[model samples]
Target: MTSETYPVDATNRVKRRHDRGRYDHATVHALLDAAALCHVAYVVDGQPYCTPTLFWREGTHLYWHGSSASRMLRNQSDGQPACLTVTHLDSLVLARCGFNHSADYRSVMAFGRARLVEEPGETARALTMMVDRFFPGRTATLRPSTGQEIKATAVVVMEIERASAKIRAKGVADDEEDYALPIYAERLPMRTLIGAPEPCPRLAGDVARPENLAAYREGRALEDALADAYRTAYP
Candidate 1:
């Protein structure tokens, strides 16, 4: 992390379309922090498995939670090699030829060893951090988790040993002959938008929305809201 870029090896090097690969920490960490979900791939008994879960980043580390009995968590309880990946689809590239069509996206792949957080205090803090990652300072307004609840939950942390970001945010990339054809070709932009908030009907009438949710307003882009949450939570 002291260096601007991570050391690239066979494990983290982007082989295909190497030009699209980014080895800098800024690009990789930005993509990881902006997304709320990630797919963690690990091998258990020589079988490969990829589990999708909500994840958050703290500097060079990534954390996620799941059921204590989860196979993925149990297998990763001890130090085990894992790959965490996050992606954001930016647009749909429509090319005249099917072979040339591809969606534009920003993605990061992080390689590391994952281990369960067994310490009670650290587990509580990690869970709280996960919640506050999307809603900054919201955990303070919530009640503490009971011992039984903590026992049933599992928190895993991975120190990012190496990471690389791959981005393709440009318009359509079609062959020269295909572009001149009559068929239409363009990039259809896409985005995740935040919908208006809905309160529970059983809630007390006097209860008002918390200040932490100010960034999650209607018509806001999901990525932008998350970015705001990250800034507020870290700052």
Candidate 2:
């Protein structure tokens, strides 16, 4: 069985609405994997910055990349403390009163110190892993990245020192007495959808759709489709 909880420190503690807090690794990873983008918060020269970037998980580490000259990447590469957050909005929840309105979402907040991944071999591998995580078997079909391209990029990873997930997946909630209100109270569910792929105008041959992308074209949720494709890919 998978572990039920992750160690939470003062930084990772969820003080408000504690009922929605989940400390398990599964919950954190689930929220992280479901989203492709994350906002990384850190301090630079005592001024705070929250830079949005694309990130991916590999084993126990979370990795993100950027231009080597990026200030955010340069600051964090030296082991600066940071917080990474991934959130997916699930719905607009309407309640009987404006004060009780809320949104359904799955979100994870992780605290950690960053590490610069400088080794050429590891850097290359990290790039490949991210590609495969988002598009299974895609790395094999594409040409290997040259050393120059790799050198131009900076890959930094974090150990995920402590993390917690806050989830609100249910419908609207309101006070008992408010249920008698005359206004219509409802929940509007939301989703991130993938549309059919458009082919390139400079096409050479008849390129068939990859099985993984085909599922996405059929309207499967991005995370669910990726999971299904990866499971079948290895088996």
Question: 86-133, model 1: which lDDT tens digit per residue?
Answer: 999999999989998999999999999999998978987888887988
Clashing pairs in 2: none
TM-scores of the candidates are: 0.97, 0.91
Candidate 2 to truth, TM:
0.91
Q: Could you give candidate 2's per-residue lDDT for residues 1-235 as a string of tens digits? A: 2356778768888889889999988778767776778999999989999999988875457898888889889898779999999888899999988898999998999888997798878987888866776777788988788878877888889988788999897788999888888889899988877776787877768877676556567466776765554454434
Off by over 4 Å in 1: none
Backbone clash pairs in model 2 (N, Cα, C under 3 Å; residues 3+ apart or in different chains), count: 0
Q: Which regions of candidate 2 deviate over 4 angstroms?
A: 1-4, 229-235
Tell me model 2's lDDT, rounded to 2 decimals.
Answer: 0.81
Model 1's TM-score against the true structure: 0.97
Cα distance off (Å), candidate 1, residue 231? 1.4
